[model samples]
Target: MIVKRPVSKSLARAFFCIVLLSLLSTGVALLTLASSLRDAEAVNIAGSLRMQSYRLGYDLQANDPQLALHRQQYGRTLDSPVFQQLHHRWVPMQVQESYALLHDRWRQMDACLARGDIIWYRQNIASYVAQIDSFVLALQHYAERKMLLVVAICLLGFGAILLLVFFTLRRINQQVVAPLSALVEASRRIEQGRFDHPPLETRLTNELGLLGRTFTRMSGELEKLYRSLEESVAEKTLSLQEANRMLEVLFHCSQALNVGTIDRRCFRHILQLVREHEPVSSVEMAVGATWRLQEGEALADAPWQTLPITMQETRFGELRWQGETADKPSPQLMQSVANMLGRGLYFNQAQKHTQQLLLMEERATIARELHDSLAQVLSYLRIQLTLLRRAVPEENRAAQGIIGDFTRALNDAYQQLRELLTTFRLTLQQADFPAALEEMIEPLRAQTAATIQLDCRLSLLALDAQQQVHLLQIIREAVLNAIKHADAQEISVSCVSAPEGHHAVYIHDDGCGIESVNEPEGHYGLTIMRERAERLGGALTISRQRNGGTLVSVSFTTLSGEQTAGRPDNNNDDND
Candidate 1:
C-alpha cells in the first residue's frame, strides 16, 4: 500500500489532455466572443442609417438650412468603421449583399438630393429605408450565428473533458485501486495477527499484483510467527494502553485546571473529565456542603476511595471515586489530581479577594475626588444662594418666590452630591451585596420615620460584583426617592426572583403617589436609576400604585444581553 511514485504516467497524460483541450476550447471561444463584441457596434451603425435616410428625405421637402449638414452626417453614418466590417469576406453572403445594395441605393438618393429633385427623392426614400432595414436584420442574424458557434464549441469541449475524466477514473479504479485495496486488506489482517481474511488479487500482471502475491505468502509465515508470541504481545499492549490512558488523563486534568480563576462549574468539569478518562464507574467532588458535583452511577453504600483536595493545612474539597474494575487509577495519580484541584480553588479565592480589594480602593479614590471637587462646589453654591435669598426684599413677594425656588434647587443638588459620595463610600464598606445594601439603607432609614423592611431572596440569583453594585445603586435611588418624596409610613425593599428566572427589586411605599416620574430640571435621580438598570441589562420603572404611593421596580433576567421590559405610567405632568 506504500506508493513511491507521486502519480502514474497514465494519469499525468490524461490530465495533460484535459488541460490542453480546456485551454484550446477556451481560447477559441474567447476569440469568437471578442470578435462578436464589435458585432453590436456594426448593428447600431447600420440601424442609424435608416433614421438618417428619413431625416434627409424630410430636409429635401422642407428645404431646411441644415440640409447640407444632415447629408454629410448621413454619409458618415453609412461609412462608419462598424459598418465597414460588413465588407469582410467572412461575413455571410446575405449580409454582404444587403450592405452592397444599401450602399448603391444611398448613392442614388444622394444624387437626387444634390440635384434638388424633390419628387424623385421622395419616391426613392422609402426603398432606401427598406434596404437599410434589411441590412440591420442581416447583421443581427450574423451575430446570433456566432453566439451559437461559441456555445457549440464550449459544449463539445465540456463533453470531451467529462468523458476523459470518466475513462481515467474507471481505469484507475480497475487497475490501480482494486489491486491496492486487496493488498491493503491483506496487510491489515496480517498486522492484526489475523491470516484467515479474504484472499488478495494476485492474477494481474503489475507491480501491485506482485505486491498482492507477496503479501499473501508473507501472511502465511507471519501467522506461524504470531501464533508463538500472541499472548505476550496482548499483555504488553494492554499494559501500554493503560499507561497511556493514565498519562493522558493527568495531562488533560492539568490543562483543565490551568485558568486565572475557578468556579463551581470548573470543579464540576474536572470531575467529569476524571470519570470520562479513568476506569471509574463513578466520580464525585464535594467542596463544602454547598457545591457537590457527581458523575456516573450513584451508589451510596459502595466502597469509595477519597483523596483530600488540599494544599498544606488548608483543604478546599474532596475527590471520591468508586469502581468494580481491577484496573483502577493509581492512588498517586488521584492524589495529584486532587492537589491540583485544591490549588486551583485556592488561587480562585485569592484572585477574587485581591480583585475585591482593588475595586474598593478604586471606589474610595473616586469618592474622595468627588467630595473634594464637585461636593465643595455644590456647598459653595448653596451658601451663595442663601445669601442672595437674604438680600432679597421681603416686601416683593414675586422676588421672594423666585429666591425660594433657587434655594430649593440648590439644596436638592447638594443633597444629591452628598448621596453620591455616600454611595461610593458605602461600596467600599462591604464586598457582599446584601451587606452593602443594608449599609446603604441604614442611613436612609434614619432620615425618615417610615418603617423600612428589607426582603432579599437572592439565593437563587448569582450576581457578579459589578452587577451587584449596579443593582444596589438602583435600589438606593428608588428608596431615596420614596423617603424624600413619598410621605409614607412604610417602605418595602424586596429583591426576589420570578418563576422564569427573572430577578427584580421592588421599592414600594405606602405614601402619596408621585404625580410624574420625570425628574425636575436640576434633578437626575430617575435618569441615573435608568442608566444603572441598563448597565445591568435591565429596565427601571417608576409608577404609582393603584391605591396610593409610588412603586419603583427594576427587573432583569439571569442571562445577559436581554433588555427587560418596563411599563411605567406615561404621565407627562410637570413636577413642580
Candidate 2:
C-alpha cells in the first residue's frame, strides 16, 4: 500500500529521545529518593526500639530489685543511659501498640520486685531481657531489608535508563539519519538524470515521513522542468538555424535582381522567382493603371481595385497573388518579404527613371545583357576562388602562396565590379510592386527548410496597375520583415477589404516576438516599415503577441469613383 511519509522524522526522534530520557532520569531520581527515605526510616525505627528496651529495663529496676540486679548482671546497663534519653521523648501512637507487651512485662517485673519475691524477680528480669533483645534484633533486620530494597530499586533505575538511551539512539539512526542519507543519494541520481528508482519509503508515521513525501514530489517537478528546458533549448536552436538559412536566401535573391532596371520582364522574372522559391498558386500583375492579363484570361476577382494607391500625390501600381487556401503564411515571413519588396520597388523605380534621363534605352538594354551574362559568370568564378582559398591549408606554403595571389586579384576585381554594378543599378528604376516583393521573398523561402504559406489576397484587375504595385510592395515588405526579424516558424499573410474602400494587409507570425522598443532608433525594421507605410499614405501598426511573435498590419484608402471607373478592363483574381 502506498503511504505518505512523515515530514520530520529527525525532529520527532529527537523529541521522543528527550522525553524518554527525562522520564528515565525522573524515575531514577525518584527511586533514589525513595530509597534514601526508606533507609532513614529504618534507622529511626531501629534506634527507637533500642531506646524502648533500655527505658523498660530502667523503669523495672526500681519496682523489682531482684530483676534490676539480674538486668545488671546481664550487662543491660551498658546501653541504659542512651536508651533513657530516647524514651524521655514522646513516641508515636502507631508505634505504641507494638510496644504495649513490653510495657506490660516491665510492670509485671516491677510488681514482683515490690512483693520482695527476689527469685521470681530475677527469673522474670532474665526473660524480659531476652524479649528486649529479640525486639532489637527484629528492628535491625527490618532496617537491613529496607536498605536492600533501596539498593535493588537503584539498580533497576540505572538499567532502565541505559535501555532508554540505547533505544533512542537506534531509532534516530534508523528513522532519521538513515533515511536522510538515502534521500541525499537519490537527489544526486536525479541530478544526473537517472530517475530509475522509487523514492525511499519511510514507515514512520511522523514528520520524517512527511518530509520524504515532499522530497518525492519535488523530484518529480524538477524532472519535468528539466525535460521542458531541454525541449525549449532544442526548439530555439532549430529556430536560429532556420533564421540563418532564410537570411542566406534573402542575400542571394538580392544579388540576383540587383543587376537590372524595372521592366515587364523583370516583373515576370519576379513572378518566376516566387514560383521557384515558394509554392505560389497564382500570380497577377497590373501596370500603368491596366491589368497585364485580358478580361477573360484573368484568374480571379481582384481585391486591390478599391484600395487607395496615391500617397502624397504619387501613384504606384499594385500587384496581388494568392496561394493555396489550405496553407497560411506566418507573420514574420510576410514581413520579411514585405521589406524586401519595398527596397526592390525603390531600386527598380530608380533604375527606370535613370533610363528615361539618359535617353539610351537601347544602350541600356545591351549593357544589361552583358552585365547579366558575364557579370554572373565572373561572380561564380569569384565564389569558386573563395572556396578554393579556404580549402588551401595554412601549413602548405606553396598552395597558400598561390592561393593568396589569386584571391587578392579576384577580391580586387570583384570589389570594382561590385561598385560599378551598384552605381549602374542605382541608375535603374524600381520594379513595380509585384516584381519587387516577389524578388525579395523568393530567396528567403528557398534558403530555409521551413514551410512557407504565402497568401496575396489583393485584386489587381479592379484597380489600376499602379495601385496593384503599391499594395503588392506593402504586403511583400511586411512578410519579409516578419520572416527575418520575428524568427517565426510560420507566417500568415492576408488582405481583407476595409471600410471606406480601403485595403488592409495583415502579417502575423508564430515566433519569438520583436522587442517592444518604444524608440524608433531601437528597431530599424519597425522604423523602415513605418516609413514605407507613411510614404504610401498608409498607416503601419506593429504589435508583439502575448504568447509569442509579432503582427504587422498596413492599411490605406484607395482612389475614388473616377479612378475606379477609368480602368474598364480591371480583373480581380480570387486566389483563395
Candidate 3:
C-alpha cells in the first residue's frame, strides 16, 4: 500500500521548519562559544611572562645557580599550547604580530642567559614584558569579539525562530483550527436539519482540508436525501387523505342502500355524494331500461365512464360519470359502489314484492269480512222487505208506495255492497302500474263497443305502492263514470307527467255531457272521486269538452320529486 505523505505546505511542515531553525541557531552559538574557551587561558599564560622576566633578572643580579632552571621553566611556559594558538591563521593581525615579537624577545633572553650578558638581559626584559602584555591585550580583545559573535548568533537565531513560529501558528490556525471550527458548526447545522450553511474551507493541503471537502459532499447528499424523504412523506400523506375520503364516501353509500326501499332519491343521493367527493362535473345512474337518476349538469356530448352495477351476476344497470378524463374515479371504488347499488335494487324488488303480498292479503281480508257481514245483512234485509211488501194489503196506497221505495233502495244497497266487495278484493297481481291499469280497463272495454285506449307515461315518475293504488282507483272511477253515465262511444285513459313537476291522469270519453253537477239521491260517484283526489293531495276536475264528451283529470305530485303528501288508507273502496 502506498501511503500519501503530507505536503510540505502543511501545518506539520511549518512546525518542523521552526524547530530546525531553533536547532541551527543553538548549534552555531554553542560552536562559537566553544572556539573562544581557550582565549582566557592564553591571556593568563601571557601575563605570567612578566613574572618570569622579573625572576630571571633577579637571578642575573644575584648570581643564583638556579637561574638556568628558571630559564628552562620560562621557555616551556612561552611554548605552551594556549600561547601557540595565537600564531595560527584565525588570530587577529595585531595579536599575531605581538606573539611573534614576544617569541623573538624570549629567544634573545635565553641566549643572553647562556652567554651571561646580564646588562643586556636586564635592559630588554621590561620591553619584552610590555610586548607580552600587548599580546595578552590583543588575545583578550579577540575573545571579547568571539563572545559578541556568539551573542549576535543567538539573537539572530532567536529572532528567526520567533518569526517562523509566528508564521507556523498562523498557518495552523488557518489549516487546522478554522476548518475544525467550520466542521463543528456544520455538524450542528446538520443536527438542526438545516443543510444550507456557508461553504467550508477546503483549499488547504492538510487533513482538515480533506475533512472539509468530504463533509461538504456529505452534506450535499444529505440535503438531497432529506428532500426526497420530505417528498415521499408528502405523497404518503396525500394518499392517506385520499384513502380516508374514499372510505367515507363508501360508508355513506352503504348507509343509504341499507334501507328497505331504495328509490330514485336514494340513488340520486349517492350520485350527489360522488360529485361532492370526486372531481366530477356530472354523474348519472341508469337503473333498468327506464329508471334514471342524475345530479349536476346533464351534458349529452361529454365523454363518460360507465361502470356496470351488478350483483349475483344480474346487472341492474350502469353508473356513468362525466368529467375530465384525468379526474376518473378509482375502478375499485366505483365498482364497489355499483355492486352496492345492485344490491339495493335487489332489496328494493324484494321489499316491493313483500309489500304487494301483504297488501293483497289485507285486501282479501277486507273483502272476506265485507262479504260475511255487510253483504249477508243487506241480502237478508232485501228478502224481509220483499216478504213484507207481499204481506201488505192492496189498499193504503201511500204505505204500499213507501214499501216499493224501500224495496228499490234495498236492491241498490245490495248491488253497491257487491261492487264494494269486488273492488276491495282487487290486487296488483304482480303487475306494474300500467299492467294493472290495463287489467282494470279490460273489463270496461267489454262493457263498451267504443275503442278504449290506455296511454301511460308514469315510468319516469316511479310511483310507490300507495301512489299506484290511489291513482289506479281514481282512473278506474273516472272510466266507470264515463261508461255508466257519460254514454261515451270512445274513451281514453292516459297517465303522464304534467308540467310544473306533477303527474296527471286523464280519462276522456266522447259522449253526452252531464246535465247537472249535483249527484242524484243514493249516488256518490263524483263525491267519492273527489274524496280520493283529495287523499292523493290533488284536484280532480270533471268538465264537459266542447266536442260533446266529459274529461276527468287528476293532477298530483310525487314524494320523491317536487311535492308529496301523507298517504290515505290503501283499503278505500272504489265506490264509483
Candidate 4:
C-alpha cells in the first residue's frame, strides 16, 4: 500500500487513478449499506409476536359479555394460522432453540384453552407469554446493536483506508523525494501562508533543513503576532460577555416596570448588577430630583469620573464609577448602565402620571353621572316631602310622628346620594402615599364640623396604585362613618410603621361609639369599609375610641404589585 514513486509523471498519474477507483468502490459499498438500513424498518416479526402474546392474555381475562369479542381480537394474531407459519418458516439456526420452544408452547396453550383445562391453561399461558416477551426483547436488542456495529465497522474501515493513503503519501515524500523536494513542498506551503507544518528535524537534514529552519524562524515571528491577535480576541470576547450581562440586567429592570413594581431601590439594584461585571470600587447613579442610587463605599472623599445619562433630549442623571484604573472601564460602559436606569425610571414616572390623569378624568365623569340622574331624583323627593310636612296638622301627635319619620328617611337618602357624588368628584393628585392621604382627608373636614387632623409617618412602605386606591377608600369610609354615625368634635388620622415592617392606618374620632358593628340594613357603610380593607390584604378594626368615639384602622405589609378583588365568574355557572 506504500505507493511512493519517484518523480515520474505517468506512474504518479496511474497510481492516483487506481486509488480513486478503489475509493469509488468503497463508496458503492456504503450506499448498499444505506439501502439495507432503510429495508430494516420492515423487520417487525418480534414486535408483532409481542403484541399477539398480550392479546391472548387479555382474551383469557375477559368478562362474560366481552369474552367473545376478546377471543376474536386474539384469533386475528397468535391464535391464527398465519402467525404459526411465520414463526416456523424463517427457522434461523442461531435462534432455533427459542423458536422451537415458543412454537411448542403456542400449540400447548391452544389445546388447553380448547379443552377448558383452567389450571394448566393458566400456568402454561403465563410461561408462554413470558418466554415470548423475553425472546422479542432479545431480538430488539440484537437488531439495535447489530445496526450500530455495522455502521461503526464501515466508517472505521473507510477511515483506515484514508489513513493508509495518507501514510503512503508521507512515505513517498520523505524517502523517495530528497531535500530539494522538501524545500519545494515547504515553499508551496509557505506560498499558501499556512505555518502549521511538521518539524524540520524529521525531514532530510541537508539544505532542506536549513530552508525549514528559515521558515520556522519566520513562522515563530508570525507566532508572536498570532499570540497578540489571540489576546485581542479574548479581550473582545470578554467585552461581548459583559455587554450581554448588561442586556439581561436591562431586561429584568424592564420587567419590574411592566409589573408596576414601584421600588424605591430600583436604581440601586441596577447599579449592583453593573458592579457584578465591572471592576469598580463604587457606583453612584443620580436619577431625577430626589432618587439617587449609591452603592459601595461613598466616593465623596476620592476623585471619580462621571458619565452623563440622557433620554429623549432630557438629561435626567449621571453615573459615577470609581475604579483602580483610569481607562480600563470605558465611559460608554458607565453610561450604558445609567441610560437603562434613567429611561426605565422615566417610563415608570410617565405611566404613573398618565394613569393618574385618566383616573381623575373618569372620576369627574362618574360624579357628573350621579349628579344628573340620582341627585335630581332625590331633590324632587325632598321638595315633595317638604310640601307634605307643611300640610300636616299641627296638633295631631300620631300624624306628626309619621311625618317626622318620613322626613328623616328622606334626609338620610339625600345625604347618602350627596356622599356618593362627593366620593367620585375628587382624585389622587400625586403618587406619594402621604400626599394621597392628605388629599383624601381634605373633604371630610368640610363635610363635618369635626376637626380633621392627619398624622402620617409612612415612609418605609411603598404601595402601588391598587393598594393606594384601596387604602384611600377604606380611610374615606371610616371618616364618613364617623361623621354620619359617630357625632364627634375631633377626628385624627394616624399612619405609622408597625412591627415587622407592616404599616398601620388609624382614623379616630371623638364621637358616638357603636355598641353593635353587625351588618344591619342601615349600617351598609361599615360593610363597605370592611370590604375595602380586605382588598388591601389587611383587616379593618372598628372599636370605641378612648374618649367615647370610633377608631377605625387598617394594617398591611409591603406588596409585590397592584392587586385587586377578582370579579365573580358568571361563566362558572355554565360549567356547573
Best by lDDT: 3
TM-scores for every predicted model: 0.43, 0.36, 0.71, 0.45
Model 2 TM-score is: 0.36
Per-residue lDDT for 44-82 in model 2, tens only?
554454454445455565554455555443334323433
Model 1, 1-576: lDDT tens digits are 443433366678889999999998888899889889999888888888877877887888888888889989988888888877777787899998998888888788888899879999777777777888888899999999999989998998999889999998997886689878876776777677678878776765656666777877888777877875777788889878867876787788777767654554566677788888777889987765334567899776768999888877887668888975877777767887898888776666555446556666666777898889988888888788788878988898998898888788778877877777776765435544466678778988889999999987663113545566678778877887788878899999998765434678999999999999778877777887888787666899989999999989999865421221132321211110
Q: Rate the local accuracy (lDDT) of all candidates.
A: 0.76, 0.55, 0.78, 0.64
The model with the greater lDDT, 3 or 4, is 3
Query: What would you estimate as the lDDT of candidate 1?
Result: 0.76
Count residue pairs with overlapping backbones in model 4.
0
After superposing candidate 4 on the true structure, give the runs of residues whose Cα lies further than 4 Å from its correct spot. 1-226, 248-359, 441-461, 477-492, 496-501, 508-524, 545-550, 557-576
Candidate 1 is scored at a TM of 0.43
Give the higher-lDDT candidate: 2 or 4.
4
Each candidate structure's count of clashing pairs: 0, 91, 0, 0
Instruction: State in Å the error of residue 167, model 3.
Output: 3.2
Clashes of 2: 91
What clash pairs does model 4 have?
Answer: none
Tens digits of per-residue lDDT, candidate 3, 250-328, equal 9999887766566666777788888888877888887545557777886778888899988789776889988745667
Once fitted onto the true fold, the runs of candidate 2 whose alpha carbons sit more than 4 angstroms away are: 1-137, 152-249, 260-327, 349-576
Could you list the CA RMSD of all candidates, in the order they appear?
43.3, 27.9, 6.1, 43.6
Question: What ranking emerges by TM-score with the best candidate at the front?
Answer: 3, 4, 1, 2
Write model 4 residue lDDT over 1-576, tens digit each, in one string.
122333354336546755774676556656545534522332355456656655655555552455446445544544344234334443334344565677677677666655556668566666776777665555455456555656676676667667766766765565445555655666677567655655553343334445556767877787687778879999999889877766776676556445453454455566776676667778877644333556787655667778877778767667877884454565565666667766765665565556556666766777787788878987888788788778887888888888788778888888777766676666877665677788778866888998999987764124555566667778887887788888889988998764333778998988878767676664356776777677666898878756698778788875432222232312111110
